[model samples]
Target: MKNILLILIFTSMAWGETPHDGMHHTHEEHVHEKFVDGKKLEVDPERFDKFIMDLKDTQIAIVNVQGMVCDFCARGIEKIFKKDINVKKIDVDLSKGKVLIAYNVAHEIIFEDIRDKILMNGQNAIDMQVIDL
Candidate 1:
């Protein structure tokens, strides 16, 4: 058993798969780590969309945001959107670098205001299109 363990260790080191190997750096050590370590979980796109659409009837707008690095950046945008009482949901598509904002009608919020809010979070909102209900 001991020999087997030693052999496995030697092989891992030889192949640069061990913790001390060249590419074994912890994610936290990365300079541009966009997500918190161990928090890079992914959700199914269908489920995420369904969750967002469940919001109360209001205005839904899809905004294309450029240069979103990761979920952390998306969460930052979400936080900003949440500050508005009219906001119902904020869905981010990091793959395409966009955010879908759903607002409650009670507040009569407009697209320009949503765009400004997104930009205020340090993301560039390239375009906004209302989702046809």
Candidate 2:
């Protein structure tokens, strides 16, 4: 009876349904679909250009960044700014280690968030300014 009970317990443990198995399988399928059909969406070049122009026109403030030592450093800073939904346009000069950030008025502008993001990415946020326009 003892041996039979042990066998049953071991069998149950071996055959137990794992909740994570199905989740991982579904996640892989979702990733595959994203990689396959994600590139099919077409973007109009004129519309895209206009979208950028519109963003530039709506910028309320600019943040001048510093401590960007090299191209890799500037690229890192650019990548962080790209994550911000409020940032419209980013102009970075690797040689000068400066960044000009243009923000959209339609979105809630938070210079602190931008500053924090750049600093967190191992750079400096030098100055903040209202757009001249």
Candidate 3:
């Protein structure tokens, strides 16, 4: 068992799959970390839209934002949105200049508060629309 473990460790290191801060990093995670604009945890746009299309008793808001030029901006927006207890999923698409937020129906947050959350992140939220699903 010890020899197998040692061999696996060496193989992982040789393959650039070393543990990061004691956590195993997946290939996708490594790609995201190395590429500044790929930090968002989202499926492809088409798949995302379809996934949101059938959700019941949920609030989906798509916000057009300005000043989201980097990964930090995207992550900052995510952190701010997560403050709302009901926000279940967050997807930031810097390429589209949009932030997609989904919250539970039982605790829908006011639009003004959602806008405030975006604005508080030093981002200019141009507009937001609630998508019915």
Model 1 scores worst on lDDT over the 10 consecutive residues at 17-26
Which candidate has the top score in lDDT?
A: 3
Tens digits of per-residue lDDT, candidate 3, 1-133, equal: 9999999998886532111111111122231123233334223457456647657777666666777789875787888778767887888877777777777866654556766777687766665555434
What's the lDDT of the predicted structure labeled candidate 1? 0.58
lDDT tens string, model 1, 1-133? 9999999998886532111111111122222222234433233346445755566555556566666777876687888888877777777888766676676655554556665676676666655545323
Across 14-106, the per-residue lDDT of candidate 2 in tens digits comes to 542211110000111222123133321122334324434645445434345556677765677778778877776776655444455666656
Query: How far out, in Å, is residue 98 in model 1?
Result: 1.4
Q: Candidate 1 has which clashing residue pairs, if any?
A: none
Ranking by TM-score: 3, 1, 2
Q: Who is ahead in lDDT, 1 or 3?
A: 3
How well does each candidate superpose onto the true structure, as a TM-score? 0.56, 0.50, 0.58
Q: What is the lDDT of residue 101 in candidate 2?
A: 62
Higher-ranked by TM-score: 1 or 2:
1
Best by TM-score: 3
Model 3 regions lying over 4 Å from their true place:
1-47, 50-55
